[model samples]
Structure formats: C-alpha cells, structure tokens
Target: MNIAIMGAGLSGLACAITLEKAGIRPAIFEKRSQVGDRFVNGEALLSIFTHPDRDNIATFSDQYGIYLSPTSHIQRMELFSKNKKAVIEGHLGFSNIRGREQDSFEAQLERQTKSTIKFHSEETYEQLLSDYTHVVLAAGDGAYSKSMKNFREDFTVSIKGVTISGKFDRYTVMSWLDYDLAPFGYGFLIPYSEKEANLSIAIPDIPKNAHVHISDLWDVFYQKVRSQLVQNLPITDQFQITQYPIGICNSPRIGNTYFVGNCYGSMMPFMGFGQYAAILSGVYAAYDLCGMGNYEELMKPLRQSYENSLVLRKAMEQLSNEGLDRIIHSLQGDWADKLFQSHRINPLKIASYLLRPYIKLKNE
Candidate 1:
C-alpha cells in the first residue's frame, strides 16, 4: 500500500519507524529543512501522566522497538503556589530536549528510521491524498486537522519561554501556579543540563485571562524564579507562541487519512503533557494501516485521558489563589508521595472524576 506521512516531527517519525518495521516504507514529508527544526526547549515526561508504564523511554524501546535517551531522569519536582511550596522526590520521570539539537527526541527518532523524508516540501494534504493510498497527518499541531473539519478545539494557549544559562539541578524540575504571576496559567523550569534550562509559562485563552498581557506576566514570573532559585539567570534565547490550539480530533481515522500527534489531540489539556500518547498514536496508526489493529480502538485510552485532563483544566481555571495554595500545601508530605510515586493510582483520572461535580457546580 502506498502511504504518505506528513510532518517529520515526533508522531510522523514514529509512524515511519513503525511502518518500516512492518516492511512498509511510507513516504514522509517535512515542511522544515530537518526534523526538530525549531526553537530548542526542555520538556518533561511525567510518570504520573504515563502511568502503568514508568520509564517511557524503556517502554518505547521494549514494546515498540523505538529507543530514546533522555537528557536526565527527573528525580525531583518543586511545586510553588502563591503562598506555599512543595517538593516531591523520587523516580518522577524524565527531561528531554526538544527542537534542533542533535540529541533531541526528534533527532533520535529520525536516526532510527530508514524511510527517506522529503524535507522543505510544501505538499498539501489535498495534494498528497491524490497520490498516496493512505495519508497520515502528523503536522505537529491541530491546524491541518481543524482545516479538515476533524478537530474539536477545546482551548488555545499563549506561551512565552526562554533558554537561560544558570546553575541548575538537571534532575529537578520546578513549576509555579501563582495566579498573580500567570493568571490561570502556569510557569515551569525544565533543565536540559546542569548549566542550562528552559523557563516558560503557558496561559490559556479564556475571558478572564483576556486582559492578561503575557509579557507583563512573564516579567513577574522571571522575578519569582530569580527569587526562588536565588540566581540571576541570563537568558540566551527566547520564543513566544500565541493562540496555540490544544484539542482533539473527532476521529483518529477519517476515510484513509489518519491523524496523529498533536493533530490527534494527544496533548492533555491539564498541563500539556502528551509525548507518550503522541508517540503511541503514530504507532497505533501504523498498526491499523498494516492491518494489525484498529486505530480508533487503540486511541480510546488517550482520548479518555484528554477528557479527564479537560475536566481538571476547567476546575483549575475556576480556582482562586487560596485554593491553589491549599492544593500545594496538601502535596507536601505523604500525600505528594502517594500521588506522584504510586503506579497503581492514576491521579489524573481520579482528580478528574472527583472534580467533575465541582466543575459542574462552578459552571452553573
């Protein structure tokens, strides 16, 4: 079967690699000159988000024959609210570099694939459909899916981030949930190494946050990071994204065309963690194409996770600073350990179910 995969990002590359394993070398197309050709940033793979299977890298390698090396294992995570701070330590997850770096996840995946990618190509979906038997749209975002009338946009987020040079604990990641600094948004610091990290904030687009200027919020967040870390981190590079869509596809497969990655709505609405789900979507799509499995059936868990995360996101948006402070304080001791370290408990699902009534009440 002739197949074409769009956008050589995480999902597209994963799909290509999986297809190759099944003896199908699908044609891959990338709009950029190379894979991961964008701003460099640090991202986390939280074990809580990918429960039942901790150590995502190992899971990928062992289960799917996809090997990836993380920049560092996340052993500690610091959560800061407006009035309280909590530290949770253990085998949290991992931190990996994203974008143009040679060791980035995209580069790692690109190396594993034997399929040739047509880089710098402006092949549109409509154009590819006429040439290939099946087309997999993994364009790294929901734009193409939305254009195809297959995407249901839940929300958009404004993000501003920078790569800073500073002393950092590569295994520790920090996050801020203070509304004064980011409104209904959150700030994070994910270190790529002992001397470099990506500090960023993501603010959801809602009416209450309509007047929130990201630059102003960023200034506050930067100062907070400086005070908390007690370092004047020098920014080496910066990037800004506005109205970035976070949503899901109505269906994983529509006709012979498949949606994967962010295009498939693998990104969770709660904290935007979906690397595992995104990779799985691609592999699942490839499996469906090879007549090994059904794409829709494989994506059920990911879709459920998205729905759960959306519920939590709605609840979080309604919370006041006092509420956030209480939540952070509650995560201080044994509770934090149980919530983060326990493999049996899916915190996202539990939290979503518990907060559903509260969310409904708030909405009413």
Candidate 2:
C-alpha cells in the first residue's frame, strides 16, 4: 500500500522510519525548507520516556536509529506559588535535542529516512488525500480539524524562551505558578547544558482580563522569573519563540487519513510534553498499516493518560492562590513521588474529582 505523510516533524519522521523498516517506503512532504525548523519547542527537554518500564531514552534511540543525547537527568522540580514553594522529586528526566541544527536529533532522524521531502509543496490536505492511498496528517495546529467531527480545541499554548549564558542547576527543573508570569499557565526552566539553558513559559493565549501577546508574555516572564533566576547571566542574542494550538480528538483517524501529533492532541495537557505520544502515534500507525498491530489498541493507555491530565488541569484551574500554596506544600517526599510516578491511579476518580465543584453548583 502506498502512503504519504505530511510534515517532517518528529511524528512524521518516526512514521516514515517505521514504514521504511517494514520495507514500505512512504512519501514525505514538509513545508519547511529544512527538517525541525517548523517545530517551535524542539529544544525543550522531554522526560516521560525516562521511566524504568519504558525503554531507556538512549536505548530507545539506538533501537530506533534516532539520535538522542543525554544532557542532564533532572528528577526534581521546584514549584513556586506566589507565597509558598514546594520541591517535588521523582523520575522526571530530560534530553537535549537542538532544532534545525544538522546534529540535532530530528535532523539526524530525517536523514535516516532517506526519502525525498517535497519541500515547499503547496498541495492542500484534500489534494493529498485524493492522490495518496493513505495520508498521515502529522502537521500540527488543527491541520484536519474541520474534516474530523470529534475534534475539540482546548487552547493555544504560547511558548516563549531565551537562551542564557550562565550556570544553570542541571539537577532540577524549576517552575512558578505566579499569575504575573502566566495568568493561566506556568513558567519553567529546562537546562540544555551546564552553561546554557532554555528559560521558557507556556501560558494560555486567551487569558481572562488580559490582552496579552507573545512578546508581552515574554516581558512578564523575564520580570518574574528570568530576572531573579539568572541575575548576572547574560541573555544570548539567539532566542526563539512561537505558539501552537492543542486539543483532544476522539476520532484521530477516519477512512484513509490518520491524525498524529498536536493535530490529534498527543501532548500532555499538564505541561505540553508530546514527543513520546507523537512518536508513538506515528510508529503505531506504521504498524497498523503493515497489519502488525492495532493503532487504537496501542493508543489506549495514552488516551487515558491524556484524559487524566485534562482532569488535573481542570482541578488546577479552580484553585485559589492560597489553595495552590497549600497543595504545593502538601506534595512532598513519598506523596510527590507517588503523584508523579504512579500511573496506576484511576483516571475515572480524578475525573470525578474535577466534576465535584461543577456538580455542587448545579445542585445549588
């Protein structure tokens, strides 16, 4: 069966790689001139794959023939509320993958596909669907949202960050819940190396009572976190910032078209980490096409996890500053470990917890 994949991002590349491994070469189309250029947050460290049950990131890379390098292993995060702070430690880990560079992980993986990418191809989604036997929509930002009926848009996430030249604590990732940095989102620091790190904030685009743009959000982030965290650290001239929309889709695939990555809401709702989901979606798609596995069956666990993340996100939205402070402080030691590491927690229970506030309002 002939297949066509759109976009050269991680998901698309992963899909192509898997198909090539299965001896079915798929045609790849990328809008960008070079691989990884379109991905706005490619440099940020991803941690979910570091779990013991999961393949060690290095091993996974070796097994899949993708290039991924270890930067720093961070197992703890320092969370700050307006008044209180908490330190939660667990299996949080990260890797360094530079975007657009030749040595970057995505670039290396793209090279392995050995397929000619129709760069700057102007074929519309409908046109591609008509021409290819099967089309994989790896292009994110609601690429096939209108075509699919069950697609529900959640919100736009604005990612703003600057590289700084200074020593960053490689042992921990930092986050703050102050309203100033992000009225509806949070600020973070992910160290790329000991001397250089990406200081970024992911906030909702349309925040209540705020007329905010990407530039304005960066200014607020600088004043609230960067100014304090990197006191004498010089902000490098090279920096990147962008925004993308994310949502959940009940029907990711219909007929011959498959939706992957952000278009299918593979990102974790809590912090927007999606590389794992994106890659997995693509790999499973290849397997299904080759009649080796069921894509939906493979995605069941991730779908449930996404639902759980949404439940937590809703619960976080209702918290007052003081409540947030209390919750942060309460999460410590074994409690924090269990919360972060335990995947056995029933998502249904969390969903019920999120509904309690709304249920009470309906009764009143």
Candidate 3:
C-alpha cells in the first residue's frame, strides 16, 4: 500500500514506521525542513513510560532504538499555596528526551525508518491526496481536514511557556509552584539531575476580555512567580522560549483521513502528554485502516482513550467556566488540584474513565 502521511511529527512518523514494519510503503510530507524542529523548539515534555508500548511512548523509543535519559526518580509530589500539601498517589512525570538537546526524537525516527520524508515540505491536503493511495492527516488538529467537517477546539487559556534547564537546588517538580511565581498555571522543576532541573512555567493568556500573547504572560507570570518562589535560582541558563496553544478539543477528528497527535486534539490541558494519546491513536488508525486486525477489537483501546479524554475534558472545561474561582480555591486546599491534574495528566485514570466509553463505542 502506498501511504502518504502529512506532518512528520510523532504520530505521522510512527504510523509510517508501523506500516513499514507491516511491509507497506509510506511517504511523509512535512512542512518543516527538519523533523521535530517545531516540537523540539516548542519544549515538548511527555510521561516516562509507566505503560506498555502498544500505545506507550517507551515502545516508540525501543522500536527506533532512541536512548532517553531519565530526568528524575520522582522523589516527591506535593502541591502548595498558602499551605503545602502532599499529593497522595499520583507521581511526578519526568522530563524526557524531547526536552533534551542531544537527540531530537523526530529526526531519529525519520533516519531510522529510511522512510521518505520530504522536508522543508509543503502542499495542500488535496495536493497531497492525489499523490498517494492513502493520505493520513498526521498533522494534529487545527488545520481543516477534508475528511472531517470541523476542527477541534482549543481548551485551556492559551499560554506561552518558557522552559529552562539548569542545576537547581530544588529536587522536585512541586518545589517551584509557589503563588508568587506560577499563578493561573503551574511550574515544573523537573529534575534532570540532583543539581540540574528543567524549570518550566505555563504563562496563561489574560482571561475573558484581555489581549495577551504568551510573551506577555511569560514576562508577568515569571516575574511574579520567581519573586515569590525561586528568587535566588540563577537565570543563567535561559535555554529557549516557545509558545504552544494548549487545551482539550471538543472532540477528536475522525473520518476518512486520520488526524493524530496534536492534529487530532492535543489532549493536553496540563502537563503535555499528548504523545501517549497520539501514539495510541496512530496504532489504532493504522491497524484498522490497514486491515491487519479485528476492526473493533484493534481499535477498542484507542477509541476508549480518545472518547474518555473528550468526555472528561468537556466536563472540566464546563466546570472551569462555571466555577473556576471556587475550583481553584478548592484546589488550593483539597484534592481539587490533584483531580484537575489527574483528569488530564494521568493516563491510568483516563483509561479507567473510559470503561463506559469502550462499551459505548462498541455499541455505536
């Protein structure tokens, strides 16, 4: 089968690799000259593989033989405000190879596959469609897909993020989330080393009726947060400043063409773990479309995960809009923050949340 994948990010590339493994030829169409350049420069951070590779990220690394360093052992997880509280169960997700400079994961995938990825590439969805038997819209949602009538919605208060990697005296990701610094959003002091950490803050756009970009938020939020929290931490290593529009989509885009990864719907309202969802979605789309397995059976997990994410995300967004102040205050004291974090960040919970989703999908 001749397959053309649009957008050479994780989802597209992974799909190509899977097809190749199945003895199919797939061509990648990328808008950027270099693979992962956008994602790399964008400061993407994902979960360390606690799940299996069927849709797990660790499987992707192993499949391609990409070596990733563990940034932290996840020593502690505690939320703080006026009072410091220890989160009961959910562990801290470590910063993975995506944040590291040495090996950009996208490039490695491209090189390993010998998959034809015409870089610095550009063409319309129609132009691409004419060229291949199958055109997988690997570009995550936002771009209009001919297969789908509408685009996914951006959920969070769009934010600009500045991530810096340097030696920090602080040990945990929670160490940096002080009111002085990361109000509106949070801070992650991901332990790259006992001494080094990836200090990141999500600077949110001004709410409701405000005109603000990420840079403005970064300036205001950083100054505020840093003044209260890490006043003494050296800003010596200001590595990169990148902005990503984050939020859950109203729904995942599914049609004749498959939209995976950021294109399908980022599925990241908190700590960007869209790659996991993206991977799983890619696997399902590939297997189903390629006619390799039971259509419903192969896609059960994938559909469940996506639908589960959508349902919870919609609920949370409604909750946020309806009573955000009260919710934030509650999170300040109780498990509200933990719940908020988990609803989006925790895949295990997400999977469990999908129990009914799978059943409903099977019914439909």
The candidate scoring highest on TM-score is 1
C-alpha-based local distance difference test score of model 2: 0.69
Q: Candidate 2 on 1-364: residue-level lDDT in tens?
A: 7899998887888889888888898888888778877432224443443233233466457756555555656677888887878786766656455576565657767877877788887777888888899998888557476456657766566777666677777777788886655766777777766787667777666546247666776776676664667466667734544456667777767787878876677887667777777777888888888888887787777676676566556555666677777867776567666655555654344654666555322113
Error of 2 at 361 (Å): 14
Sliding window of 10 residues with minimal summed lDDT for model 3: 48-57
Residues 1-364, model 3: lDDT tens digits? 5677888776787677777766776778888766765423222233322232322235556754333334443434545443344442334344444522445556556665667888777787878777766677777655454235444343344434334444443334553333344444555555444444445565344343144444544565556545655554554344433344443323443335666666665455434457666655565557666787533454445544444544443343233322443433454533643542342455544534654343322213
Ranking by TM-score: 1, 2, 3
lDDT of each: 0.92, 0.69, 0.51
Winner on lDDT (1 vs 3): 1
Put down candidate 1 lDDT per residue, 1-364, tens digits, no spaces.
7999998988999999999999999999999998999999999999898877878988999999999999999989999999999999999999999999999999999999999999998999999999999999999899989998889998899999999999999999999999998888899999999999999999998899988878878888898899878999999999999999999998899999999999999889889898899899999999999999999999998898888889989999999999999999989997787778887898889988998887753223
Candidate 3 to native Cα RMSD, angstroms:
6.5
Mark the 10 consecutive residues where model 1 has the least summed lDDT: 355-364
Clash count list over all predictions: 0, 0, 9
Candidate maximizing lDDT: 1
| Rank order (by lDDT, best first) | 1, 2, 3
